[model samples]
Target: MKRYTLSSLITRLASFEEALAQKMDAKGYVEAAERARRYASEIREIRDFIIVEMTLEPIETLDPMEFLDDAANPEEVDNLRRRVYTKIAEDVEPVSGELADLLRRLSS
Candidate 1:
């Protein structure tokens, strides 16, 4: 299975919301309304899973240079990456079973 980052999922959800808004503004009322409802449901599920299951704390923005600093350890970075991947894989499954596949297709 492909690995997914929380940031990527958040970005996709933003894009989906934008597209749904545009559709609603366009002439496709019925279809757009249906899609909007579905998107809302999906977003709710993701939010609930993140908040309830993961009990995620507020994310802090880190500078790339901080990770790339001369004193930064490679092993530590690898360990952090593995932990993030494991968390995403475990937490996202209950909310969206097709999330990994959707992310793969989107990237492709």
Candidate 2:
């Protein structure tokens, strides 16, 4: 059986998101956000590959602006952060699972 390439998955997802972003409305914003969350999940899978293969931390540091300590409204900003992270995490599992399986196959 042929395997799907990570690059192909990412390109297809990005193209879909770009197309969806063209619409203007609350629905479009929601769709864009959903796509972004999926992209973030794919990013984390790529991060895992860098960590596993190159032995490196992918992100150098968190942006201070993203945190409560730096935001004007700490609670609101923190809540938003939590929501975004949660959404991204929800999308991440399946992609990461696929990556893990690929890695296992490579090693075996």
Candidate 3:
């Protein structure tokens, strides 16, 4: 069984959110969507990375700029964001148990 560390998950979540913000600032909805999609994809990868890093490989830190690069195009990022959000919302539903709370904050 693989151990899941909360600290690493928190780090990856923060990084993903930060990157999404940068993607929004750098581009329009489309680019933002693309970036969001990639971010979602990478989140899963990061999860896997966390599991592996705990047992096998050492984790490599990301460059500050790495988060904002591919997702900088607004239109692309927006599309990605929508898809990613949909997927993530579904995946996180059971554990979070606070969709309304999240939505309220997100809307604010």
What are the TM-scores, per candidate, against the unseen true structure? 0.33, 0.28, 0.39
> How many backbone clashes does every candidate have?
0, 0, 27
lDDT of 2: 0.37
What tens digits encode model 3's per-residue C-alpha lDDT throughout 43-97? Answer: 5444443333334322233332333445555554444444444443344434342
By TM-score, the best candidate is 3
**Quick one: best lDDT, which candidate?**
3
Q: Residue 65 of model 1: what lDDT?
A: 27
The alpha-carbon lDDT assigned to residue 32 of candidate 2 equals 42
Please give the CA lDDT of all the candidate structures: 0.41, 0.37, 0.43
What lDDT does model 3 reach? 0.43
Off by over 4 Å in 2: 1-3, 25-108
Q: lDDT score, residue 24, model 3?
A: 67
lDDT of 2 at 97: 46
Give the Å error, residue 103, model 2.
Answer: 20
